[model samples]
Structures are given as C-alpha cells and as structure tokens.
Target: MSESGKTNPMDEQTPDAVTEADILIGRIVDGEADEQDRTDFERLADADPLLWRAVATRHQDMASLCDEVDHEIAMATTLELPDFVAPRRAPRWAVALSGWAAVLILAVIWTTMPQSKGIEGLPPARPVQINPDDELTFEQHMQQYLLAPYVMGELDPIVFRVEELPDGRQAIHYVRRIEAFEFLDADEELPVNDKGHLTIDPSELHAPVGPASIAETVH
Candidate 1:
C-alpha cells in the first residue's frame, strides 16, 4: 500500500468478486465466455495472482480429464471382441428387459449347475490375449464389449417392442447392455407413424438439414 501511496485493489477483494471470478473460470472452462468476458477475466487475474492460479489449476485438471476420455473413445473405435463359440439365442421376448437380464440369468444358472467330474465333459475356456501387434489393449476390448450392441444397431428402437402412450407418444423400452454396464429398464419417448412404427423427421436431426434453413444452402 505504501509503495505507490495507494491501496491495492487485491487487498480489498470482496465475496462478490470471488464468486464472479469463479463464474468466469467456469465459463472459460466450458468455452462459453465471450471476448469481453475473457478481457475482464484477464484484468481480474492481473489484479490477483491467486485467482489466476486457481483458474489455471482447474483448467489443467479438466484438460487432463478430456484427454483421458478421448483416449478411451479412440481405444473403443479400434477394439475387437473376443472370439467365442456361439450359443443358441433364445427367441425374442415380447417385453423389453434391462440389458443384463439375459446375461445375469445365464450366470445364475451356470453357478447353480452341477460340475462335471470328468475334464472332457465341457470344452476349456479359451485364454484371452492382448498382443500389441495383433490384439487390442484390455481397456479397448472392454469398451468393445460394452458398445457392441450400440455400434451394430442392435439397440435401436426397431429391435425392441414399442408401446403407444395415451398422449400419442411412443414408449421404446429396452436394456442396452455394455459389458459390466447395464442400462436397466430404460425407456425413451419417440414419435410414431400411423402404422405405429417409430418415426423421426429428418429435419429434426439437424437445423441445417431442414429444407427451410437458409444457412444450409449458404454453407
């Protein structure tokens, strides 16, 4: 305070200033701040080094998390499922159950079944391998297992029974299981055609895709 014969603004930091700075930091992190907001944030940072440091730390953490997610998605795109002998699939059930329902049922049955005394009674389970030259990483393999149905379009509304609601909305009920993750008893509302099939307007997919959108032609 004595150096310039004036009180420092940083020394008079109020609770409102701290709250505003936090809001600014969140906006910056989310990439929602405007140029003027950025300018004000910088001004505040220059006035208070501690505030700048706090923002920097949070930014770095968020960046690291984003990198990790990107890495997982990259892995998922390249991963392959383990080769296994196909078992007979049961006929499709009329009602949609959670993704893990069938798997959990099988697991329970397998656990309760009597074990064979002879080694030749059942085939030995194949060993899983993940060689970098020919196989995907363990993480990638897991991601593949979890996302296989979604990737293959098996989780589409067409695959599940759709019920009409009293309000003219269609309820799509199904479990989309991905490895250990289970979308349990999940349901979604969808528009339906006169034939009672799920229908989606292409225009609703994207603003630019609509016939009336001028920005689409300009682009």
Candidate 2:
C-alpha cells in the first residue's frame, strides 16, 4: 500500500519473495531460481510487459546466448541454462566470457548436426557406363560357324562358346579347329584383370574335357 492506505498494483505479490524486476533479472540474467521463484517470475512477466522486455534486453546483452530451449527443461544437462538445439554464431568474445556454457552449446550442436570429420580422405567415385547397343554376347556368335556342317551326320554335336573364358580352348570358327570343353571346380573362380576373359562356371560342367576332336590345334 505504498506505506499508506492506497491500493498498489504490486501489493498482490509476495512481499518478501522477490520484486518483478528482481525475478526477471534472476530468471533471465543470472538464471537462479527455485520452483516458487520461477512461478513468481512467470506471474510477474504475465502481469508486466516492462518486466519481460527488461529480461529480453539483459539476455541479448549476451548475444547468441539467447537460444531455443528444449521442450522439457529436464532434458538440459546443465539445468537452468537453456538447451541450444541449433548453435548460433557470434563474435568469440560473446561466448568466450560465458565459460563452459558456450562449450556445452557447441558440443550439442556438433552432435546433432551432420558434419564430416575426414572429408578430404574421400574422393567421389567415377561412374561406369556401358553402351549396350554395340555389345555382343558370346551366345550370339555361336551359330555362325560352330554348327556349320562340313560333313552332315559324320559325328556332330552342339557347341558352346568359350571365348569369354580364359582357360577356354580356341575358336571353332577358325580353320577346322575343334574346341575342347572342360569343367571348373568350386574354388576355380580365378580373379582376372579383364573379367570378360574369365567366364568359366564355378560349378562343374555337364561333361568333362577329354581330347580336342580334330587333332592338333590349328593356331
């Protein structure tokens, strides 16, 4: 009552608890508060716009320090101080004076954001492209000479192309060359510099190689 019998706006608040300016100053500036202290500060801020503004000014005095706090304050490892979801950049001096609070904010941001540690170690891979139109598969050329009958019914058998295979015999299309077919073992997937050169199946073939049918290799 202003030490007299007159209605005062502040008379409704706790006399010894804290002043509105003091509550805002404590909550926003110094960040010291108990449960009742925070409640009192909230009520004061709701009732007084000047108190809220004063608090904002004091907070921004430490620019980049005022940030988005977490939804539940308990999630903040350093209770009372706000949780920084996204780090704000400012002059080093602004955060420099705040001690570990600044470090904590930066740590949270680094953990949450996508940042590369060893970016220089990796170079982008080159794309491999093949022009499918010009390419010919081994099966396509098998018909040209492998089955051309020199003497019909004089011992003929269907031939399989093995040019794509390295351990493979010579081409049947050349001369009277008769290519022999062989079976490869399970462990016989030999690594080759040119993968197209090795087309032997990892599993055994239907028939094992005996001798070249004609006689000596033509080439």
Candidate 3:
C-alpha cells in the first residue's frame, strides 16, 4: 500500500488499518484521503508513473478488500450468533451457591436475634436441683411448751424416726421430742414401784414354762 515509496505513519493506532502505506495508497484514484494526505498524494502522483500504478493497484486491492469486508459486515449485521449459546445453562452446582447464600443469611439472623426464651417460653429457671437426701434439713420445728401452768401430765416421750446414721448405728432423726413436767399431781404411777413388786414378778410369772425352761429345770 506504499505510494511513491513514502510511508504514512498514522494508521497504526486503529487495529483494522495498521499501515501508513495503506493510507497513502488509499488517497489516490478515489480522492478520499485526508487534507494532509491529499496534498502528499498529489505530489507523489504528479512526479512518478510507477507511483501512480502502484497507488492504482493499492486502491484496487483496497476496493476489493472493502467489498469483501462489506460482505462480511452485511452478514454480521443480518445474522445472529446463535443467541450466545446461553452460557451452557450455568451448571447445577453453580446455581446451588444461592442456596448456600440463603443458609448464611439465615444463620446470621439466628445469631443476631434476641434469645430471652426458647421457641416457646423457656422452662422456669431451675434454681437448684435440691437433692433432698442430705439428711432432711428441717427449717422449723414446733413443739408444745411443756412447762406451762396446768398442762403437765404423764406424757410419754415422743419417738423419732431412726434414720440411717453415718456411723451405721442408725441415729434418730429427732423428728419429735417431748418431755414430762412436774405441774400436775399424779394419783397413780406407772408401776407399784420401780423395785420388783410382786404383782407378777419374773420369778412367779412364767410363760407356762417353755420346753427349754422345763428341760433346764430337769437338768
């Protein structure tokens, strides 16, 4: 595309037209060069026939290329490229990333929401388990005031539950306690006397003498 052996340098910037020779040759025969290239083309076309022929051939080549390019451009303008193939339907695994994103969003909401209760109301706080086996710690115990004015009598000693003790002898739980008082005068006592009075003394009252006792008597 050279004209009169001189080269044009500005065509390098555009990708499709890369040579100054192309531009120089394009100026002749068609009269379509820019103002500056036109002046240069006229100078070269006037001085040399060889330059004119070369420019004509270059012009012819450019026209043929232009027609070929026009045909390609017409086809490109008319034809579509199969709708860009729809990017291959985006692979099933790739679409699943949206699910992962949704899960992350739900997790964030759960982490940030207030937690005053469970899904319903949380069970009332179990202050303590309170095993209740630790020997029954009694907070209070009520007892009759035995030393009152007229109440004292022959009250038997109150019994207690003999709970299991640590030393294994079974200590009493002290669940009840009573005491006798001296306020009331007694008409009768439990026994005739603390000594062996003979209402039914052990020596006199036998259980009809068991066989062992009979045998002992014989022996």
Q: Pick the candidate with the highest lDDT.
A: 1
**Alpha-carbon runs more than 4 Å astray in model 1:** 1-18, 70-208, 211-219
Ranking, lDDT, top scorer first: 1, 3, 2
**Error of model 1, residue 202, in angstroms:** 16
lDDT of model number 2? 0.36
Q: Write the per-residue lDDT of candidate 2 for residues 1-219, one digit (tens) a residue.
A: 221122335656655444445544656566676677767767766766566666676677645444434334435543343313213443221232111111111111223223422112222222324233333222221222233222111112223332333444333211112233344456765433485443433122333333234212321
Full-model lDDT for every candidate: 0.43, 0.36, 0.37
What does candidate 1's lDDT look like per residue over 6-73, in tens digits?
23455477422335577677899888999988998788778776767676777898999999998888
Distance from true location, Cα of 186 in model 2, Å: 55
Per-model TM values vs. the true structure: 0.29, 0.20, 0.25
- Output the lDDT of residue 107, model 1: 18
Candidate 2 segments exceeding 4 Å error: 1-19, 63-219
Clashes of each: 1, 0, 1
Model 3's number of clashes is 1
Alpha carbon RMSD to native, model 1: 20.6
